[model samples]
Target: MSNSQITAVTELDRSHYKTKVYSGGHFIYADEPTDVGGTDEGMPPAALLLASLGSCTAITIRMYADRKNYNLDSIKIDLAICKEEEMNKDTTITRKIEFTGDLTEDERQRLFVIADKCPIHKMLSNPIKIVTS
Candidate 1:
């Protein structure tokens, strides 16, 4: 099986913890210093994951509309993630997609289906194997 991977390296310095996250050979800085009560200024890992999902959902819908030649004016996605109980064994994410412009009932329904089929949504819904060295 083929797999994709991202690497995140973090270093703790005098001011805050600095991190460099890499995906597809591209790197981005993610740091948060202790002064602001964040363990630095970068987003916590969970927040990053949420952002990915939100972005993927919105983009996927936009792509679908454009491909289908639908007159979609705007697409907005709102997402919230909640951990299950104290154990954190399970997490629930709720997504709300709002579409603007003229759309038929069929087009709207199809968009909802397409949104669920986004890459990030599939990743979150399917079982995942994580290896830590």
Candidate 2:
């Protein structure tokens, strides 16, 4: 087992329903929307989770294409995520990748295979342990 550890810190501001998160010198704010009594200061936790998955998928595909010297102009990834309680608290995330460039069908199809191979995708598909104090 790997002993490597990654950590982040978040503090809640007393004034509003917002959180300040610090990780590796980057600061992120997370909050609930105004409809839920928050000031809509930043992205909700759900959106943040979805963004991580989508961005990771795009970068993975881009890196693979670049390694092969594929002429890829643009890449677009769209993901929709939802939680279902009926399935014993199961969550589903659907991803759609759009590539804009001169590419063959095989290249495009190969990207689909590569998308699922992203680290984040693998993490989500597998079991994870979350320990909180």
**Candidate 2, 21-111: lDDT as tens digits:** 8987999899888987988989888788889899889889999999998878888988877743333447678888999999999999998
lDDT of 1 by residue, 5-35 (tens): 5455555556455566766567666665476
* C-alpha lDDT (0 to 100) for residue 65 of candidate 2: 98
Error of 2 at 107 (Å): 0.5
**lDDT (C-alpha) at residue 35 in model 1:** 63
Instruction: List per-candidate RMSD values in Å.
Output: 3.7, 2.9
| lDDT leader | 2
lDDT value, residue 27 of candidate 1 = 68
Q: Please give the distance, in angstroms, between residue 72's alpha carbon in candidate 2 and its true position after superposition.
A: 1.1
- Predict model 1's lDDT versus the native: 0.77
